[model samples]
Structure formats: C-alpha cells, structure tokens
Target: MDVELKSLTGNGTWSVVSLPKDKKPVGCKWVYKIKRNPDGTVERFKARLVAKGFTQQEGVDFIDTFSPVAKLVTVKLLLALAATQKWSLTQMDVTNAFLHGDLEEEIYMSLPPGYTDTSSGSLPPRPVSSNDTAAEEALKILLRSHFKIKDLGPLKFFLGLEIARSSQGISVSQRKYCLELISDTGLIGSKPVTVPLDPNVSSHKETGPTLVDLTPYRALVGPHMKAAQRVVRYLKSNPGQGLFYSVNSDMQLKAFGDADWAQCPETRRSVSGFCVFLGSSLISWKAKKQHTVSRSSTEAEYRALANTTCCAPDKGGEKDCGADFSKGHDRFKSSERCLLLDGDDVAYTEWF
Candidate 1:
C-alpha cells in the first residue's frame, strides 16, 4: 500500500483540494491482489487505489467513457503475422496505466481510507503524445520521457493466456487459468470428461424447471450449472491444449461460416458463427445470437456471412492485418480472399 501511494503521489495523479459547493465527491478504496506465476508460486503483491466510479452520476460526473484496449482477435492476428515473419515479441508494462489518460470533467474524489489528509483531491489533466519509432533507443527514450515504463523482456503470460514462441510457431493457452478456474469450483479431483456438455440434453429458457436455490447455480453458471462444470472437467483433460500459429503458413485467408435458424426457443433468433484462417492459423472467430429474427435459413446464412466479412481483416489496415480484403462491398478487392455464398436462391449483392 505504501509503494502504491508513493507511486500515485510521485506521478502527480491528484492534488489536495477543498470540496466545492453543490458537488458530490466519489470515494476511493485500496484493492490488494497476489499475482502468481504459472507454477502457482507467488510472483509479487500488488495494491491499487480504485475510485468508486459507480457512485457518480452519468451525465454530470462524466459524459462518455472510453478505455483503449486491444481486442483478443487483434492479439491473435498479430501473433500469427509475427510468427510468419519470424519477428521477436517483447512484453512491456506501464508503471501506472491510469496516469496516461486525462479526465475531461472536473471531478473530485475523497481521500483513500488510511490516508490522514482531510481534504479531497482533484485529478489534473495529463498530456499524451504519439510518435513513430525509427529505432529501439528512440522508442525507449520517447516512452520514458512521458511515463514510467517497465520492460518485461519477452511475452509469456498475459490476460490469463500463456504465450510461447518456438521454431515451429507460437502457441497460446490458458493452462494456468484453466486449473485455477477448476480449483475455484472444487473440481480439481473430479474425473475428466471427453465432451464439454451432453448433446442430448437440450436446454431452453422456458423448458427447464425453475431453480429453487439460485445462489450456488449463479455462482457456478448462469443457468446450466451442471453443464458448465462438465466444461471445466473437459478442460482438465487437456489444460495445455491451445492454438498454434505455424511459421510455415502460406499467408492465405480462408473463411467458413454457418448458422442455426430459429435455434433460440424463446426469442426465435438465429445463432450464427464464423471462423477465419490466415494460412492454417485461426485468427478470428465469433459465435453470437442475431439481433433480429430471420425468417428463412438463407437469410440467417447471409447474415452470418455478412458478419464474417466485417470482422475479417481488411486491406486498409494491411500493415498489421495480413489479409487484403475490402470491408464494405460484398466482393473482396483481393482475388485470393472472398466471402462466397453458393445457392440458387442467394443473389450476390453489395451490402455492408
């Protein structure tokens, strides 16, 4: 806690201020956590001062909220491209992520619990800069000037996913995360299952009996507690199982899409899914319920196709994304990649 407070104060994140008239201040508390390694050994202890942002009124305290974060799909795609190019992947951490951004609204936060300061603190705006790095030294010097940065050497564990690079390719898995999840549910000693869930047991929102004790059910799973447990058991069978991006990939894009029309009993909405492959390496994929109900299977399939096209890599950002395909038109600009729907009833038309 002392280290955390010192860092915050050193960064000049907030300054002592008196509460203004006709204004409400949000409270803050210290959050502690033990960060562990993949071997289940304690790596370090962390403490963070978190503001009770939930207490603030939406329109008054803040008009909009935005957090700059890289999507999982983007990570995978970058890894795939890096593996193909045989590029080195380095991991880095910002000393204080919260210090990088500036708050537009004039908001006040009460002093943390253990602090002796009686006056409230107002967060001051900070500057952020962007520049292209021509060399390694230039990049480091540029970053160090603006914020405190720490280099963790090579990429390994991030966001619960373990990463490994080899001559064959890079492999990513959630082995440690899987074990922790299983242990939390008290299923460490449970027998492993071949399947995640039984296909014969069809689940419906209105068909199942109401659970009298919702506490345990909600803790384990939203609706299907038993099925969710089985998924954990299946995960235990091969916790180290993960996706591999091969170095010998040909850098060709292949997409596959499918849909289940009227699968949801209550909403009658179609469930659609699609997966895109960059030369045998699966880069992006999603399975989601459609926003609106589709009357025919053809409509559902086309909707799935449309969703896949938008999510797939585009030529505009071809530097990071290897695939050279257009975003809006029904046809891809590159002849090598396309979303082709084959059926007599289906007509090829430009629809975003």
Candidate 2:
C-alpha cells in the first residue's frame, strides 16, 4: 500500500484542492490481488487504487467512455503470425499505467483511504523491429524515461492464455486458468468427462425445480451449475488441449460457415457457426444466434456466410477460402478472388 501511495504521489497523479460547491467527488478504494505463476506459485502481490466511476453521471461526468483494447481475434492473429513466422515475442507491464494518462474532464474524487489530502481519481505498445537487440533496448529506455514499467522478459502467460514456443511452433492454452476454475467449483476430485455437456441431460431431461436463491451459483457458474461442472470435468480430461500454430503452416486464410435454421425453440432463430483458419492454425471461431429470423435454410446459410466474410479480412499475398454451399445467393458472386470448393469441384468464387 505504501509503495502504491508513493508511486501515485511521486507521479503527481492528483493535486490537493478545495472541493467545488456543485461537485460531489467520487469515492476511491484500494484493490489487492495475488499474482500467481503458471505453476500456482506466488509471483507477487499487486495493489491498485481506483475510483468509483459508476456513481458519476454520463455526459455530465464524461462524454466518452471509450477505452482502447486489442480485439481477441487480433491477438489470435498476431500469435498465429508470430508462430508461423518464428518471430520473437515479449511481454511487459507498465506500473501505474492508468496514472500516466491525462484527464479531460474536471471531475473530482474523494481522498484515498488513510490519506489526509483531497484528490480525485480518474480512469484512462507498438511492435519493435525483428532481430534488432540494440533498437529494442533503445525503445525500452525511451519508454522507461516517460513512465514506470517493468520488463518482464519473454511472454509466457498473459490474459489467462499460456503461451509456449518450440521448434515446431507455438502452443497456447489456459491450463492454470482451467485448474483454478475447477478448484473453485469444488470439482477437483470429480471424474473427468469426455464431452463438455451431456446431450441426454440437456435435451431429454425435464426442467428441474426452480433455484430460488442463486447466490451460491452466481459467482462463476450460472443457473445451470451442473452443466458448468460438466464443462469443468471435460476440461479436466484434457486441460492442456489448445491450438498449435505450426511453423510449417502457410499464410492462407480459410473460413467455413454454416447455419441451422430455426434451431432455437423459443425464438425460432437460426444459429450461425463459423471457424476461420490462418493456414492450419485455427485463429477464430464463433457460434452465435442470428438477430433476425431466416425464412429458409438457404437464407440462414447465406447469413452465416456473410458473418464469416466480415471476419475474414483480406491480407496481402494471402489466399482466402470460403465454403461453397450453393448458388442460391448470387449477391456474393462477384469478380474477385476466392477459393471455393463445392464437392469435388474446386474453383474461384467472387470475393466480397
């Protein structure tokens, strides 16, 4: 706590000032977390001071609530590219990163606990060139000059994903995350299951008695706590099973999309499912219920294809492949490049 206070004070995060008559300062709290290694060992304890921004009114307290974040697809794409290209990957964390940014709103925050001063709390890297050690060091020094950061060395575990690089390629998984989740759900001694959810229980079984109090099952699991436990058991069966971005893989981007018409009993909406691959590595996949209803199976399949096309962006010097269902939808037929395979026939379809 003292270390955090010193960092906040030394960085000039806030200046003591008299409270304005028309303003009600937001409260602040200290959050603590125990950082652990992949082996479930203690790495360090982290402390962060944050403001209760939820109490402030929108537009009046802040106009924009946007915060930059890397998309999961983008992250997966980067990992795939790095593995295929055999590029070096590193990870670093900026200490008090949120404190380095400047605020635009004239908002105030209550004094931090145990502090006598008045202040307000507000909430707020690019890739380096390859094989250039001197350039990387220079970039690190430049960043350190402006803000406090810790160079944690090579990337191993980040965002609950464990990354391991080998001569073959890169392996990404969430072994530790899965174990923690299983332990939290008291499924440590539970027998592992082959499938995530039991088909018989989900389809044939009647609805169980209503769970009036959902407090026990609310934290991590949902109302279907048994189903969640089944998933955990399945994860326990092969916890380390994850995507392997092989070095021998190519840069080709292939996508397969399909949909089931009227799959949902209540909504009668089609469920679209798609999986995108960068070479042999599965970079992205999703199964989502379509917003609107589709009249026919062909329409549902077309909607699924459209969703897949939006996710599969064109890359330079890379071929794009999409599953060729039928020619019911000519709207996607154009004079562009696309690898379409319908049965034994392999041809180029229009790329949108």
Candidate 3:
C-alpha cells in the first residue's frame, strides 16, 4: 500500500514545515507481520509504521500517559453475556490505531527512511533564529496541513484476541497464538496441570540462596503469564463453550470473597480474592495483594470483604461500621457470615 499525504484542511496540497529548536524529533520504524489461520494457512501480510513512543518525554512531549483498557473480567463478562443472551459477536481491526489519535503536544518525529524529501539535497543546516518559538508553531501548522492520514477502518485484530461471530454467540479464541507460545517455550510436549497453582503449597519469603542465573526465571514467568492470557484465547477457540444463559433461572448477582492473612511472608500483606456471578455463571473474579498491612487474619478477611463489597454497583465507597472483636472470634464471624450469605451453592474459602 502507498502512503498518501492529504491536506488537513480538506484541500489537496503539500506544504514545507520547519522544526523546533529545543525538541529533538523521535525516530520511526516500519514493523512487518504475517497473519495466519488456525489451519496453518497464511491470511494476509500487514505492515505498520510506528513512532518510537518510548523516547517521548513525560511533561514536554506528553502528559497523562494513562490509557484505559477493558479489564480481563470485563472482557470475559461481555463474552459470557453474549453467550447467555445468544447474541452474535463480531471482530474488526483498525489498521493503524496510533495514527488515528490526534497529536496533542508539539511533537516532532523523524522522517521515515526512503520517504524523506531527498530533493532538498544535502541542504546546509541553519542555526535557530531568535524567534524560534513562533517559527516552530507555524511549522507545526504547515506540516499538519500537508500530511493527510486515512483511517484503515474497523478493528479486526486486538492484542491477541481472535473474534468469530456465529448465530449462537460470539466466540473469542487465540489457539494459533497460544500454540505458538507453547511451542516457543517448548512446553507443548510438557504435561498439562489441572490448576494454575498448587493450592496445598504456599510461597514463603526465601532468605536462602538466590538464583545465580535470573534469565531462566524471567523466561519461565514470562511464558506462564502468556499462557494465562491465552486462557481467554482458548475460550475464544471454543466460542461455543458452556457459557450459555438459560431462561429458567433468576438473574440475581452474587459475589464470594476471601483472603489469606499474611500471605506474603516478606511483606506480611494479605492476598485478597473475590468472584462475582450472575446466576450460576461467573462474571468477574480477582486475586490480588492488599495495599495495606493487616494486623490479623480476621482484619485481613474483613478488609477483603470490604474490597469485594465495593464491587457491587450500588455500594459507594463507605467505611465498614461493624463492631470489632478479637482475632479468632472476628475471623470466625466473618467466615460464618460470608458462608451463610453465599450458602452451599456458592463457595468462598479463606485461610492464613
């Protein structure tokens, strides 16, 4: 595909622009990728010219780098909802996503190799004049006016989520990518474990001999995370998996939360976990460490419960007003209340 420059003003024309005196233009590079199907067939070849965003400065080049992304739970919930509602799910991709975002800051980027105006032919470099600020602003306006960008349209691929739409519902899968990761790590031939972690065992603060070679550990953790993410992909693989909703049940939203006290031996911080369900189907779940240190298991459980309770849409941020008790009794009371509310149908367990 050929890159065309359009006048930002909607009129067709090219304009010469000057560069800023203080700011250095970041470099750009072209990335190439080959799209393939699960059946080992080539789908298409794609190329993207991207800016080196890493080189950007925080205050000068840009601020507020935070970008909101749909959480994993959100993604899974959407999928489950689609399956339950029997609605079709489709996937589309925007060819160049970053290019669509309007540049907010006065940023300069290096001209792509072989795409620069070579006719300017080894022109002598000129020193910045006294009125450099005004010149820079005028230059930016001219550059934006000359280079017209085209939106590649809808999104077909995102991250690694492959989407497929059908009459039953939308299926998201990443079998191809998952298999590639498995193969890359030589884990394809390894035995498959039933659980992501060993429930009986716990990780403790190890003050003993440290790993002499950290490379292997980094490699191991890297692939493991990739596999966990691929769980979403596998779900997509079988878009028809058993997430269907039935008209026979009430759509009550329920949640189960628990915590392990002093779970991190080094930090003495508890690990909190919670799962939310719409009817019998789990819609959201989380397992994470508490930000603050808890004095006891009971306190940890209480804190975890508070965190889980906040997940409820109606519950605004409110401090727990219940009376306090001794460590043992408080923990028992917390667990008892949690179980009583959840009943035998739902399972929530906590231990220190």
Candidate 4:
C-alpha cells in the first residue's frame, strides 16, 4: 500500500503532472485492531489507513466536526420500549465507518508508501513542476482512488458487548469486557468485593504535594474508564435491554436520591446521586458533585433530594412533590423493589 501510494504521487496521481510550489502534504499512519466475539472468541483482524489528523491545524484543516449522539435516557427509553413491545432487535455496523464520511474540506495528505495509480503506468522520481491549484486537484483525485475500501456489513460484536435476542427479550452483557477489565485491573486473581464501593467511608481533596510518578495512576484510570465505556457498550449492545411496557402495571415513575456529605477531601464537596425507575426497570441514574458547600449531612441529603426532584420525571401527585427523602419519610409507595442504591456506599461514586 505504501509503495502504491508513493508511486501514485510520483506519477501525478497525487501531485500534478508537474511539481507544485509551497504546499505541504500531511502525514498518515496505519492503525490496527483485533475484532472479537462476545463469547470471548477471536473474530478477525482489521486495519485502517488514517491521515495524521493531529498534524492538521484546527481552523484550517477542519472545523465544525461535532456530531450529535442519542442521550442515555433516550437509549434506556428505547430499550424499555423494545422490551415492552417485544420488537425484533437487529444490530448493523458500517465497516470503515469513519471512511464513509465525505471530507468537506480541501485536505492534502502525504502519499502513503506502496500505493500507486495503475493508469499512470510507471514514473521516475521526478519533481512535479506545476502550480499549487493543479497539484491540489491531482492529489484530491488520487485520494478518491487508489485506496481500496469495503464495508463489513452488520455488527456481531462491538466494544465487548455481546448481544443476543429471544422471544422473552434482548439480552445485553459484557462478560468478555468484564473479564478484560478484571484482567487489566489485576482483579481476576483477587477476591471479588460484594459491592464496588464502601458505604462507610468518604473522600476529600488534600492540599498535599502531588505525586511524582503519575504513570501508574494514569494506567489505573485508563482501565477504569474502559470498564465504564464497556457498561455503555452493553446498553448499546442490545436494543432489547430497554423498557418493557405492559398494560397490567400502573404507569408510575419513582425516583430515589441520596448523597455523601464532604465526599471529596480536597474540595470538601458532597457527592449527590439519584436513579429513576419505570415499572421495574432502571431508566436513568446520575452521580455528580454538589454545586455549593453543604453545612451538614442533613443539608447535603436535602440538596441531593432537591436536585433529584427537579431532574426526575414528574409523576404529579402530593406524595412525590416534596424535595426530600428524610429518614422515616414515607411519601410514595411502590409495589416493586426500589433499585436505587445509596451513592455514599458505592466506591465508584467517588470518581464522579
């Protein structure tokens, strides 16, 4: 591929018939990945030839690159709907998804080695003596061709989420991802904790000196985030993991809120959290820091409740109106078990 690319440039497939003055070509590199099945099986090898987007100037090379994605709530709602309606779930993936996007900007890239234009025949390594406009046009045309691309239809496995469908519903799991996470964290050999976090402890930010060795910290966090992404992948892995609506149950949306006071040592900021359930399924959850400083545990809990009341879906009634879940406070009743876990008890909440 590199050879063909080099030859194409020399023969005017990339540059003009003559060399252009002043224009510099951006570099590119080869990227590789191993596709895997959800069942911890090897699928196939994949490769990508990508431009060195890092080298491109922000404003000059590209602009307005933002893309919208479905919200987490939206995703959960869709899943619930699928489960309820018993919809058939199918996953399709576009091969070389990024390549399918058309380049709107006039971008010039360095010729990759081993790629050549067959129509240009053979050409000596002679400099192209041409104007910049002609050279740019030739380069663009060459880019459009020479690169052999194909789409690998459908998605069997993506981001470690294994998806399977049945008459009961769609099942989404990250058993493989979880294994990888356990391996990466060296937790496979370690005993499993009953919960991901300690309910008894709290965190706080310290003004102490920073650590000199940051590599280990970075490595730890990297896998942590990968695990979290795996959770999202699990949600997207199956379209059926969502809400399963039924006519038998009452349409009541219940939310629970909690907080850990002065969770962060450094900032002394509390961590507030909440989760909402539609029927028996968990539809939404959030763990975040409080905006203002809280004076006491009661105040922190009150703030968290207030935040949840505002954010959670309004199931308009006198029982759900009060913005507090104090001890012994009995406002709303639900026949189903509550899915909300106290945020302070979970170790993962500290990261939030």
Better of 2 and 3 by lDDT: 2
lDDT of 4: 0.49
Report the CA-based lDDT of candidate 1 relative to the real structure. 0.72
- In order, how many clashes per candidate? 0, 1, 11, 34
Task: Flag the better candidate by lDDT, 2 or 4.
Answer: 2
Pick out the ten consecutive residues of candidate 4 with the lowest summed lDDT: 119-128
The C-alpha TM-scores of every prediction are 0.82, 0.82, 0.62, 0.60
Task: Return the candidate ranking by lDDT, descending.
Answer: 1, 2, 3, 4
Question: For residues 105-174, what per-residue lDDT tens digits would candidate 4 score against the true structure?
Answer: 7667765544444211211111111224466456445644753323222223433445454556545555
Q: Which of 1 and 3 is the better model by lDDT?
A: 1
Model 1, position 34, has a per-residue lDDT of 85
Pairs of residues at least 3 apart in sequence or in different chains that clash in candidate 2: 109-120
After the best TM-score superposition of candidate 1, give how far the Cα of residue 93 lies from its true spot, in angstroms. Answer: 0.7
Give the range where candidate 3 is weakest over 10 consecutive residues by summed lDDT.
Answer: 119-128
RMSD of each: 6.1, 6.4, 13.8, 14.6
Candidate 2 residue 208 C-alpha distance from true site, Å: 2.6
Model 2 residue 287 lDDT score: 86
Error of 1 at 168 (Å): 0.9
Give the C-alpha lDDT of model 3: 0.50
Candidate 2 vs candidate 3, TM-score winner: 2
Q: Encode model 3's per-residue lDDT on 103-173: one tens digit a residue.
A: 56666667655554421111111111122456644644564455332222222333555545455544555
